[model samples]
Target: MFSWIKRGLLVSTALLSIGLVTTGTDYREVYAEEPLRLSKSVYEKPNIYKVDESEYALFHAVLPSSTDKYIHRDVSSAEVYTNYLLQFAYDMSMLKFGETISKQIEKPFQDEILPKLSEVVAETTNQLTENEWKQVKLSSKPTNGSGEKIFHLYNEESGEDIFRFHVRRDQPPKKGHWFNFHYHTFLDGHEGHHNLGDVYWGKNMPPKWMA
Candidate 1:
């Protein structure tokens, strides 16, 4: 009877160990269930950055400069790292979301802004004759955000070498100040004159009066 009882207790302990392993009841699962992973959606197409790591790093580094005005903090110091992965994940997600909008939707807005803007085309001497003046027109169109206006200067005589300008609405004193964004003279839509890379910061152009 004594021998039988000892064997029964050993068999019961062995069965309990097997049950725990099959049921996935481990300490690691507790932490895993709590959002402890650092995962992000990296947009690699169109060659935004050289490598995927650099793209994410650039986003993380610029995030503070971009968001500091909006999110002011008095903490001694805060470094985003693996320990705060969840919080970092949330912030990083928003950054990438805006990037997607700029790439997919807002970037192609040239068509919408160009047609409505004021245009001025002049002869080689910066002055158009009576008949030549009729060939050129001036117009302006601005979008809602930052009140961005794009200007297109086209000449009827040449009908080429079109100069494009992007002006911001936030000019302090001057309300309708125009600035040059790029100079693209398309060859009848066959070949583009300029590549017009992404405008990360803003219009890297001088003001009309200054230029």
Candidate 2:
């Protein structure tokens, strides 16, 4: 009876360990779905977005590359790109508001908040530069009459997953900029996203708009 009990306990512990390992791997795979690895050579053409002429025109105004002829695969990797952008935007919005809240709610943290925000912003910039984030011509493909195109920011060199920025022909411009860009953490090549929205920093020394 004692031997049987010991064996049962061992079996249960083994199963639990396996379960934990599997779960962790699954989570990692989800984020690594679309790694920034571009198998093709640099000279080889990159994919483009499938969009109509009007949409392509609008995309050109905002994005570095023209969406007139782009190729994009609707794979799990694609989601990774968009996911990065959404999360990045959320982080930035929170950081901006968090500082304000810290200042108002806990006056003691006011001194610490600005420094933390600055450090985060600087880290984000370093990540972007470390990754090969640059403008490149996209591959040619037919639009098939699709009126919209999606753009993704990726760094083939860094092999990091980033965020997605979209372009639509019908959508009106916001805050003067044609397109807005953003990214998440490690999953996203860059650390944060850029908002083309109106921001107020007040009449302080540097101003928030500079950020």
Candidate 3:
């Protein structure tokens, strides 16, 4: 009877060891292969927005390609591409203000706001690929009369709005009305305003935006 009991105990111990080995292999596969599968899904192409269809133009850059042997663009020889793009965005920002308001704040806008805005733009230049560059555009016809949005950097091909610059009339107690320039970005979920300094427009609520 004692010998039979001893044999039963040994069998139970061997079964436990086998179970532990099998469990360990399953966990290893979960840690290693499961994450690999998840990562591949996260980086998959044709990324779709979780928001409304209207927002499809704001974050469509799933994966931009820099290699140009794949697609043909007219500006292949362009060397000052980054600088030109910066200037292009800068020019579009001014156009949104129209001649009347632009003439008033030209110097301040160039001195106070431009440098900071340039820095922000420069930070994203590296992330931009040639594929995105070729399709980039500035949204036309900004809120022409007393509206908030100035313009946005949009990609026609990818349907991504990389950046949005805006200005609003502010009346602070007796401080009068001021054109508060600011911008928004696709990064950080496009939340909060990144101020670009203000231009005083007097108490009379400045002529309707581009008027």
Candidate No. with top lDDT:
3
Candidate maximizing TM-score: 3
Order the candidates by lDDT, highest first. 3, 2, 1
What's the TM-score of every candidate structure?
A: 0.20, 0.24, 0.56
Candidate 1: global Cα-lDDT? 0.27
**Best-to-worst ranking by TM-score:** 3, 2, 1
The backbone clash count of each candidate, in order, is 8, 8, 0
Q: What are the per-residue Cα lDDT tens digits for candidate 1 across 174-194? A: 333322233233333424333
| Per-model C-alpha RMSD | 26.4, 22.2, 23.9
Q: lDDT per prediction?
A: 0.27, 0.28, 0.51
Q: Give lDDT tens digits, candidate 2, residues 110-155.
A: 2223223333333443444311334211222212222222333343
Candidate 2 root-mean-square deviation in Å: 22.2
Residue 11's C-alpha lDDT in candidate 1? 11
Model 1: CA > 4 A from native: 1-131, 146-149, 155-161, 166-180, 186-211
Q: Give the TM-score of candidate 3.
A: 0.56
lDDT of 3 at 167: 83
> Which 10 consecutive residues of model 2 have the lowest summed lDDT?
1-10
TM-score of 1: 0.20
